[model samples]
Target: MYPLNLPPAQILQLSSQLLCSGLALLLVGLAAAYGLEKQLNVPTLVLAHSLTLIGPSVLKIGYVLRLVAQQRLKDETCAHAIA
Candidate 1:
């Protein structure tokens, strides 16, 4: 499902990175949003909200990429073994 035509290992690597980044973003966003709620700062709140929205999307994409990569790797191994 990913757009990139990369090897399964490469996709897996990229997905791992994305998962880390997404988790970090999600935690930071949640903390920022909670802590900044009392400040009533528009820009900061907007940034926090943006991060909150983007984090889950990135996580989902990363998860899907991981699944696809793993599936491809499994298929490749099975094909090679059967040959």
Candidate 2:
């Protein structure tokens, strides 16, 4: 049997922790935006909420692209070594 080199359950647990933390951060951001809306106005609140929603997505895309690049480099190295 080919050994499956997946991350262990503990890593999954840690990931769940990170997910929860992200959710908490999103909630806090929304609350802050709400407070700002009351203090300032609707436009500022919209900007804050948009940033809060988009920022993490942008970060995740960057991380995924980096991983893809690393994997491509490794594949090229392996092909060169084989040839």
Candidate 3:
């Protein structure tokens, strides 16, 4: 797990990196689909795209869950320190 203590700038950079990668993947998928339209069936193409997007969607959910868990741990630690 990545440390949430990462600097804001670093976090922003990581996020932008992920965003660009996802965009690139989408572009590549689109290009391939366009190029292979005659060879690939439309339903199969759509299904593959749908399944491929699930991976990123799950990744996003996992990231959010980690952030939430980190926040909760931080809150607990601070509370313990203040008591």
Candidate 4:
């Protein structure tokens, strides 16, 4: 089962990693596509398209993870205040 109780720090770390990696992938993909468009080779085209598609999805997930981490932190703070 997926762990929902990850520490906020860990979650934030994962989120940052995903965000950075996704941005890198997106940039590389766009670069490859624009830089290699004239060639139109099958492998290049596939790699570019795949990276373009996967990058945004990873970015979106990272954004969601960040939000989740923030919420968890808020909850922890509220719990502490209540106690």
Query: How would you encode candidate 4's per-residue C-alpha lDDT over 1-83 as one tens digit per residue?
Result: 23467898899999999999999999889888888777879887899978988999999999999988888889889999999
Q: Candidates sorted by TM-score, descending order?
A: 4, 1, 2, 3
TM-score-best of 1 and 3: 1
Q: What is the lDDT of residue 61 in candidate 2?
A: 47
Pick by lDDT: 2 or 4, better one: 4
Measured with C-alpha atoms, the lDDT of residue 52 in candidate 1 is: 92
For residue 52, give model 2's deviation from the true position in Å.
0.4
Q: Give me candidate 2's TM-score against the actual structure.
A: 0.54
**lDDT against the true structure, each candidate:** 0.90, 0.58, 0.61, 0.89
In model 1, the runs with Cα more than 4 Å from the true position are: none
Model 3: residue 20 alpha-carbon error in angstroms: 20
**How many pairs of residues in model 2 come into backbone collision?**
0
Candidate 4, poorest ten consecutive residues by summed lDDT = 1-10
Q: Any runs in candidate 2 off by more than 4 Å, and if so which?
A: 1-39
Write candidate 1's Cα lDDT for 1-83 as tens digits.
55679999999999999999999899889888887777858898889978898999899989999999999989889999999
lDDT of 3: 0.61
Tens digits of per-residue lDDT, candidate 2, 1-83, equal 21223333433444455555556656766776876667857777777687578656644544444454455557668999999
Root mean square deviation (Cα) for candidate 1: 1.7
- The lDDT, on a scale of 0 to 1, for candidate 4 is 0.89
